[model samples]
Target: FAAAQLQADKNDVDTRLSQVAETTAAMMDDLKVRPALAEVIKQLIAAGNVVAYLPQDRAPRVYRIDQFVLKRDNYGQFTDIIIQEKVWPSTLPEAVRTALGVKLDPNTDEKQIDVYTVVEQRDGKVTHWQEIEGKEVPGSKSDPIPTDQAGWLAPRWTVVPGSDYGRSHVTEYLGDLLSMDDNYKAITQFAAIASRVVTVVNPNSSLDVAELAAAESGDYIYGEPDTIQTLGLNKSQDFAVIKDVTATIEARVKEAFLVANYRDAERVTAEEIRSQSEELENGLGGTFSVLASELQQPIAARYLYVAAQRKLIPAIPEGIRPKIVTGLAALGRAAEVNRLRTFAADAIQILTPQVFASLVNAPAFLSRLGNEHGVSSLETLLKTEDQMAQEQQQAMAQQAMQAATPAIAEAAIGAATQDPNQGT
Candidate 1:
């Protein structure tokens, strides 16, 4: 019984150890992966590769081609990273090609692709046209080749073509250009969505303050609040979603459009696709700029709020601290006029009498205070008191003239009485 129990205990220990080991390995893998996922994704996008099957007579023909860099990061990540897709209009049956306005090529079964890679120096451009042949063109004389010389290398900006590779007989099927059209649709859709999130900024004081105040009051000012840009916080999932969807679409586009014949398909261009993708990015940037402007509206509001609050709670009464009242009232009025009501509130809330004392002693505010109320100005106040005494003396002289007028009137009446007696 003791031996049996020992064996069971040993088995339990081993199980626990195994579990720990598994957990540790899983954790380490997760730790390494979580941080590197973005880097991996970027690398994959930079290294463009597309593989897709094209439609043929009553079946699907396998075609691989690379056209252009499916723009990912620049265009909110939803813009399809397009590789040029090549389809021989001749590959379809006579009836099908006639209906589709092209003939499907039977011999040219494999597709061609152009891969763009940047040169380390001079920002030079090269194109690695990967066709069915998988051979580097310019006869391996491609300059600034990646040290780990993959099948081929290309400069990022160069417009190039692919090489010929063996054609394969595959199932021919009919489908809409859905696979090709989907990436473009996805990119435009993402751009539209991003535009909605970043509204145009109409700078109006009342509206700006009201909306911000309402938002702060826990009112849902904007539906789909996720669209609103939040600074100092994680980006909205809309952005992330756009990014993710774009990457997926771009990857698929790269697959769908990649061709195996590089040199021959040079006439097929991706300039239109590339330009549209860039426009999408520019649109996103415009939207982001508008959102940024909207976000900053609060700053002005904050300043006004603090200023008003400071004025509301004056350091001294107008009579006792006339200078203080003058200065603070000016600030308060400015805050009110500027709609910086929140800033005024914050300033008042943050400042106390002790804090105010320290702030007043600061060189800038102090200089303004002294310049506002010069020592000579205070002396003028004292001199005005002396003028008050002189004004009093002038008032006494006017009273004496009034008294003499009354006595003169009485003496004239007496003289009139005496003159009447003499006349009788």
Candidate 2:
């Protein structure tokens, strides 16, 4: 009973968290945050650093590295950031435009309004708002929110221990990309030159420049035989060398990016699959840690905050905190499941079924097992006390009929064979 109650409480918490996640996701969709997040990731891989933040509305917005500058505190945390945005007057609400006193001119390109928003730690608390044309804007003004509730999430590929910013695979392999670009340019120029025909002529030779210019394929060049040869640059060897080098660099980049050739086979073994999975998880362990901390944690906290504010979910107890399950934490859960299953197997192996049933608390054991396996409504599957009692009664009645069957059949036969004649 205690075990069942504990599991019930856990399920309730899980249910609330699930509701919060679903609500937050809906808001993200309504705010068009998914596309912005995609762009943030694209920019993160293309460049090195990117930023995403939720501004209480139309969030989370993404900022490329160039669009924002950030500062870190002594604890290597982002304490301040200023993001620049170019907003057209039309995109802004009419009230905001009127408030900003924005004017439009027919001659200029719907001249963009430069908006700068700074979120920074002030007096040990963070505050944020936007500045338009040197004037502060209404809404999103200075109110201190919890750091996690402040709605900032910055995911980097990898970073130095104390650096506020991070570097990426693209940045690491930049040299190869540059070389590929330069080699491609060279090849294009060479191909262009090779495709053209430039005729050489001696000053002493009388050549019709106009005729040559107008000549088609196989047309005669009326000049001294030695002075009319076409110039050509045979760059096949150099082209081959450049291509070989480029191929080498391309292969290296592909391998680093895990786009290398596959380990093809008719069938893959479980061990091999497990090995590959472990390799990927290990290689990306550091990156996943950063995301779990920066991206997942903040999002989870923000979702809870939003849920509470909008009354989408009931007020959560102060004692309960949402945990982002990833990396080692996720593994711990998997390990727990395995250990539970193994324990059950071992108990059954070491003891007979009757012995096991006699010694163990079957209801509690089954409930815990079902909970770990994520199977809900376990009580429905388990037999009720009344049901068990009824089944036991039916089983005993059936056994009694079976045990008396032979004696009853023998008695009937004896009476049938002798009783009629003797009584007459």
Candidate 3:
């Protein structure tokens, strides 16, 4: 019976996951498309790791740090992470000091300390936490850290992971570019060297070393008339070849980073632009998949967990764990969207009006269609059956009133025409 109950709970969670998949994907889509978020991800890819802190009151904030350590368990889950940061003595709040077991010294007001904030998780829950001062062992415990939060977890702090090998697009191509850059610099230096004019002094002329040095500084040196001839080295024809090579290298780097080349959008048709965009999206498929698994989903889950603990969002449902549905993956499946549209259109065409009406609410269906197409006007233009029925009734009432007006007028005329003489 216990096993059966566990299996039933698992089934319920799976059903809920399926139900919220699209909604989750849309949320992920919105997040991934943000310019700031993309920039952060690019930095993460370049730097190998980035620190992100989720405050209970606001959106998650990312910090670029030069020093940090991360350790993962056998299952490739982060088990221990430490962030070392320097804080000014004055800026350290009393509560923070208490958490770190720092006693205030009025005399050391201007000192800076290296605080190592460590968070350790075991079996998917944070189990150990320490904020040490100057890399010392655990100190005396003071008052319980004052927090409105109920969980043992500290504030939402996370280390956003990058490639496991610490390799990034920038790092991959940077070495080659560095050599190219050096070659350019060398060419400039050589060009400068070639530009130097050699002044040939006559062997017969008596020369003072100081005067000759001064003469070299001036435009013309004292020499026999013919000996003053300037010898200019011909400019190398290899510059064009070098330029082409550098440009090719730059293009390759951009390709690796999935950076788009500048194009004349006004001249290109929408279809062409979309085709290029789809191609680029496909090219980025592997990178996005890795990011979704390693960074995006984990950060989102951590955000949700902290938000739930802080009462910022509704408490998570029992026996249910939310999973992130990657928007990139969903968007890639354009065939699925096309299939859904085709199926719905065919079903609508084949079904009788009565059957369709009984099966689905027309206004609701229209509203959903509008939402799927991102068309706000469609939803606004659609009216419910009740609203349509009320409008029809109003039109009929006006028509009946117009029809009765002429009859009423004729009756009045007949009464007037019927003289009292008829009665007499």
Candidate 4:
């Protein structure tokens, strides 16, 4: 009986050993398959510009095969190939045909279009495939992708950076220019400079060229140089550099009369204007508030005006200084107002001296300097008393006309009633 028990124990041990070997072999297979699959996927992403994300709960072993068309050269030609999803990136064929453009049909099967060709006959012999046949659509030219194929690619194709989708988003700013090379270069240059300008105006927050280009040209941005001098846009952390430059020039032209007065003011000094200008530009109120506050600070306005006439600052006219200063400074305190501030102090520090100097020494700044003391350009620029007189005259005339209109209408009605009686 003891011998029989020992043999049974040995048999049980052998069974356990066999199970262990099978499990080990299965695990090894899984490890080997996993790495091979990952490598293939990586290559697909690089080569085909398509990305697929499979979920864990889905059948992990499943894969698919499909077709795609690529634009190769400037000429239009169609090359057909079958691509396996598992080895998409590495196995996909490079596009060899030149593309003048693409022609697509939503109603037609994409497979038909993928391998389409035109046959030309000469002397009863087929000479060549003259062209790739395409379907014509109304209201628009041939689509780059067949409408039908777009549906298939939508789920799998990843956009390469700075490619179709990227340019499409900024199509408006690109203007009517058709040369892709020129447009690309212009946009890149604009982006590089605008990014730096925004960073300087506000250190906090962030913006990219794409976002800036996407913004509406008319929208108010806080750190924009024009905003700093006009709308009290102290909080503006970012701006479109080209737009800002143009806006500044426009503002200068519109307010040229006032700027001239500020330049001629004799009482204000340059130092005072410069100080107030600094307060407006770098301070919470910015340029606008500084000008407004100057109306009350008679001494300061006079000092700024005197300084302006002495040529202590740039050649900005005096007439526009007070308003410009007020505009520049009007943005008010960060915690106090609702305007957007895109940059921080740190960003402002990053600006090259030339950029900041142009902003600080603006023509409007010089005019404001002359108006600070209220004695010189500030008084001449505002001529507030004269403005009040004209406003009062207009108001009085409107009121008088309002009072007489009813009386005149009543008299006309009375006259008409008398006229009927007189005729009778």
User: Candidate 2: misplaced stretches above 4 Å?
Assistant: 1-34, 55-59, 105-109, 122-125, 180-248, 325-424
* Regions of model 1 farther than 4 Å from truth: 1-383, 420-424
Candidate 4: regions farther than 4 A off: 1-380, 420-424
lDDT of 3 by residue, 1-424 (tens): 8975665465444334433444444443544434535556756667645555434444444555464566665544556667677777667667666666767677754666776666556544553344655543354222332211212221111233442224454565678779678868867887888878786656666554367667544465544565344576655666667777877877766766667665756586756656766776676666566566666665556545554555544565656554545433356335445655776677778996566668864554555444455442342467745689999999999999999999999999999988778966
lDDT of 4 by residue, 1-424 (tens): 7974665454343333333333332443543435534543443332422212122122122223233222211221112212222221222223312242343446765443233222222232222121322432122222243211111111111223433211111232233233434545655665665555432323343444355556796865434443221123333344355445544544443232123223456688866665655543453232123223322232233323333344443333445333223434343333212221233234357886566665552323333333222122233444343586898999999999999999999999988877555766
Q: Give the best candidate by lDDT.
A: 2
Candidate 1's error at 212, in angstroms? 46
The candidate, 2 or 4, that scores higher on lDDT is 2
Give all candidates' CA lDDT scores: 0.36, 0.74, 0.56, 0.36
Tens-place lDDT per residue, model 2, 1-424, is 9986776576555544545556666766787777777786677677767778876665577888888988876665688899999988888877777787887677878877799989886555678899898888867487897777877766677766778888885888899889988988988988998999888777677887677789899987667677677888977997999989987888777656656344688987866755655665676677677767767777767767776777766666778777767653366445567777778779888997678779876755665565555554555777766788899999999999999999999998998887566857
TM-score per candidate: 0.16, 0.65, 0.59, 0.14
Best by TM-score: 2
Sort by TM-score, top down from the best: 2, 3, 1, 4
- Give the per-residue Cα lDDT of candidate 2 at 136: 82
